[model samples]
Target: MTISALDLAAETKRLLTELGVSADRYIGGTLRVTSPVNGNEIGVLKEHSALEAKDAIEAAHQAFLEWRAVPAPKRGELVRLLGEELRAAKAALGRLVSIEVGKITSEGLGEVQEMIDICDFAVGLSRQLYGLTIATERSEHRMMESWHPLGVVGIISAFNFPVAVWSWNAALALVCGNSTVWKPSEKTPLTALAVQALFEKALKRFVAESGAAPANLSTLLIGGRDVGEALVDHPKVPLVSATGSTAMGRVVGPRLSQRFARSILELGGNNAAVICPTADLDLTLRGVAFSAMGTAGQRCTTLRRLFVHESVYDKLVPRLKTAYGSVSIGNPLETGTLVGPLIDKQAFTNMQSALEQARAAGGKVTGGERVENGAGDAFYVRPALVEMPAQTGPVEHETFAPILYVMKYTDFDQVLELHNAVPQGLSSSIFTNDMREAETFVSARGSDCGIANVNLGPSGAEIGGAFGGEKETGGGRESGSDAWKAYMRRATNTVNYGKTLPLAQGVRFDVE
Candidate 1:
């Protein structure tokens, strides 16, 4: 149920020490966690320790040789077990995520459940994986391409979504038959360890008890930034995957490229929600709220920008303001909290700077409040609304805050133009009642993003959908059929049937 960060940390540290893991001093007298509901700081251990860099790699490398041989079906079974453990640990992980990452309990639970769903879906998807056979004209040759593993995969996840992002990499990579070395967000290693425990137990249940899994199928490394860097750059890691801001993605992407390693970087999103003239006012307002404020607007898929047609801007803005006026705040673990604090002071500062930038750039600030800290004191900046930019400022940059920007658009082409203005096009939306405009956006301008929402709320981006973006959105999509393919290396096997001679075609082999 609901618990304080201090209590959770005390219990967790006790658990870690008993398990032979070392806990480090949490910096700033804060546990590196702030309530999204109020930005309250959790004064607990900020750092975590486990195996060293070499050990992390060796574990992953060892797991790979044996894991790669397991059939896909067995992989599915392991994932299934992983989902169950996640479910069993739901309440604990949810509160842990809330404190460490500044997500409200609802948002934290959403992430926990979504990760569980992703693991379950990934498990079953293994049954449909098959090779493709093709006929070549070269001397009647038949060629087939089968997918294979890329050995050890290293996934570096972000603090914003410690569980979902990790599962995004682990589920696909594992089900595709690759062992992984995971480094969770350094700031929120608590939940990651719980997740790792679940995975460890699941791997044992599916692979060992079933008498089919390899001896070492997976491993987790809980440490600092250096640990993450070491995990990714290790020569033994054949592939690398990261989900975070674009700046960090740049650093890792190049290193992987230099090493000739396969890499996938699902970076940032300045996602937008554009309400067309034909959009339903009531429906559109609700959709914008969900997109704009979901997960305290920390998701890469969160709707950060809102472009409403002048046709409906006047009708929508004030109504949205009215709806927001009643928006709940404070206490993430409380039953009725609507919005939470920024992940931490850094996030709060970023939000404050961005809000001021927007205001200096001629945007208006609606409301700004401070979140309550653990000692029942204020910690983070509350949800805020910035008026449309007369020009443009940090809105172009990915500002992961509960603060959202509202812009007024007048023309059909302008709606698309404004939506495309975002350089980091991770996910965007077009709220319209017309199927024609929605289809056109989906077919034409829609290709720019990894996730595009139409009619649906922006945060409702599906897990089974194709999600990869053009330009700064990073390479190779995660979540969907595309994800499965990205985890594989294709090998073409060809056999010549030999050309049939005219005499051979007319004669029987037995000469009966």
Candidate 2:
């Protein structure tokens, strides 16, 4: 069963209204918002121009100056309230995510849960923004390093994990005493609007309960590349945390660097998983299936490549094929549907192009045929499982679709080499029961990706760990650990209490 355009639109309108977004405020505009489930126009938004984006950045900068003076715990209070607001509207917002991004119901809710989790994490982080005291050589001298909020934070998010990625940065940035300006993907602006509306509610409550709060703490810029570029190039925006394609990163990174601005780029990933001879076939199958096919393989951490030991290769491949054949693909909102439609016709076209290249590279492909759901213009397809001779061009490059390239390896050492050969390194996993193999896979010389799992697949990452990648995936981290430091600036200080000048390395310069 598929959702009709009218039903989808009605559902979207209801969700938005429930989340405090009035229809007349955002529904009439030149930019059309559509659901990937049926390719139906869900809403319309007036795109923010480049000038408006710059004004938003300036407003965020001014808000940051005031917000930074607030006590750290007080800043945390606002995030705590935001968490409450997100919890209250999780269902409405999660469904909006599913409608906009084509995520399954569970995945959609999981994304909102991520937002709430990050808010909780940031609330805790607010009081724990620690500074370090260094030992001084000179008598009666003290040295330390402190953190202060950077100006405005610019966030550029993609369509796949629309709301979650923004929260990862915004929550941390807020706790760090920085204001944010967000530019969501053109494909999924409604979710951004919904999130901002919820945030506004949280802010209002915070102001009523607390003494003061910045009204422009979080601003949304809805537009295309031009608006995003304005955010990246703005001098007031000292840091820009962007999540999108490597191609987008290639442009964003340089533009920021030209101004010496900081960037946390969450780019593309060609993730892979290795299966050992001692691996539990049942556990490995479940891990591989969800990681490869979940969210239609649009996750940055989606497992796109698989390496199985020759001993278990023949056994696992057939089981995987059967599993792929049994997967239910249809409307994402429907229960029991494991796979949802790709974001649009372009995504379908890209998937087909990658499959053709895989075939030319001597691959045995199974599935990947388009499914004829009743929804008009929705692009649903069966996930493809390909047995490849080697890691060819198509296998190495990241394709945002449900295509898993499988290969067999006789030696562990050689397989590790093949795993790290790709240009993009985001997430990787190895399924092995052997203690030595498991340790080796996660060891210093193990999977080269930023996130390496012993028995788990790489798709779902928790908020407690720093998330990102190396190489072309952009060597930037977000979500947890010391990721909050990226949103602030550091300063070193030396104070002398005695009437003597202090010098480092036993070298002193005395002013005459």
Candidate 3:
């Protein structure tokens, strides 16, 4: 059973109000907000037009001028305050994530926790934005490089991780001394509004504690493709961090490149896992279960394909099938519910179409049936486990649902080939206790994904490591490590203390 539209709307309003968003602020527009958990119309948001999006970019650019001059540690204080606000309202914000995006209770809270984690990470990174000091060839010369803030950072986020992705970019962008303009997914605008409200509270606290902060330090543009285009094409926005499908990246990547602006594109992932003969069956079962079925398999790192050694394929497939049979699918807000509804009916149709194609390709599919929740329009589905003869056909494409395609492999070398065969290079993993196999999997020649792991699933990437992928995944990194460099510009400087005017490399200039 699912919550009624009226109840869901009431709860949504309550959460928003608690988070400091007024009713008139987000409502009174044609942009309808629907809850994926029960297919209920939660509310309506006034969508920003393309013109407003451009204006937002200009405003953020102006804010960047002032924010860039502030001390990095002072900028970090704002992020710290934002982290406190997120922690205080984590429960309400987490529930709002579930209400808007259909993530399970734990995952919903986990998303907010991710935001808080990035803020903590950014707070420390402010003082650590170190530059390099190079040893110069010339006598009495000092050469060094320093990083300075870039202009407006435009962030276009996807629905699966509605709020966390924005925080990933915004937090780092803030610490790096750049202002941010966010274009959240149209389907999940309410969470963005709530987050913006929380950010505003953090900003007020920041100003009270510190001296001043720019007016548009972080701007939220709630709209569809046109708004995203305005952000992408805006000349002032020097960096754009986009997280969505590869097709979206194909459009966004070149558009930024054409204008010589920077882009951090976190695109699609047809992630896979290899189960070796020496792998722990229990651990592999659990890893595969959560990686493929978690978030209804909507995550970018969702395990879409699996390659198992012929020695253990028989042992693991049955266990995986049993696990899939027991997943509880219902409203995401309900505790103990491991799985939740798909984002919409379109996602359900996509899953069915992929299953049909798998069948036509001589694949035997189990599960992938729809569950009847009391809410007629909500889509709850059984996660499908399909056994295929080869890694071809629909298996190569990411269906954005809980469908795991399993194939058998005899050799470790051959399995690696099958693993990197897909166009995506986001995340991959191998479950093996063998030290050589594990080392080889992460070695230069192994799994050609940005993230490769041994005895771990491809999903649930931590924020400490720079997150992104290569090839069609867009070659962009975000959240952690030196990713803050992408939001700032670098300058190399050389100073000569010697009085003599000497030319380097033994070059001589003669004057008459």
Rank candidates by lDDT, best first: 3, 2, 1
Model 3 regions more than 4 Å off: 1-6
Distance from true position, residue 475, model 3, in Å? 0.8
* TM-score (C-alpha) between model 3 and the true structure: 0.99
How would you encode candidate 3's per-residue C-alpha lDDT over 1-512 as one tens digit per residue? 33554388888999999999999976789899899877878888888899998888888988999999999999999999999999999999999999898999999999999999999999999999999999988898899999999989999999999999999999999999999999999999999999999999999999998988989999999889999999999999999999999999999999999999999999989999999999999999989999999999999999999999999988999999989998888878877999998999999999999999999999999999998868777899999999999988999998999999999999889888889888999999999999999999999989999999888899998999999998899899999888899999999999999997678788999787
Query: What TM-score do all the candidates reach, one by one?
Result: 0.88, 0.99, 0.99
Per-candidate Cα lDDT values, in order, are: 0.72, 0.93, 0.93
Give lDDT tens digits, candidate 1, residues 1-512. Answer: 23333354454455444433445533333335443333344334443343476676777677777877888887788888888878877777776677667677787788888888888789888786778998655556677998987788888888778888788888888888888887777667667766766676776677556776665466666667787778667788878888888888888888888888888888888887778888888888788787777667777778777887787778888888876667776566667877765666677678878888887888888865564445343344556777775428877888878777888877777667767876786777888888887887788655367667787665755677766665677865777765787787889997766775223235545442
Q: Report how far residue 166 has shifted in candidate 2, in Å.
A: 0.5
- Looking at candidate 2, what is the lDDT of residue 132? 100
Question: Which regions of candidate 2 fall more than 4 Å away from where they truly are?
Answer: 508-512
Q: Cα lDDT for residue 157, model 3?
A: 95
Where does the lowest 10-residue lDDT sum fall in candidate 1? Answer: 34-43
Positional deviation of 341 in candidate 1, in angstroms? 1.4
What TM-score does prediction 2 earn? 0.99
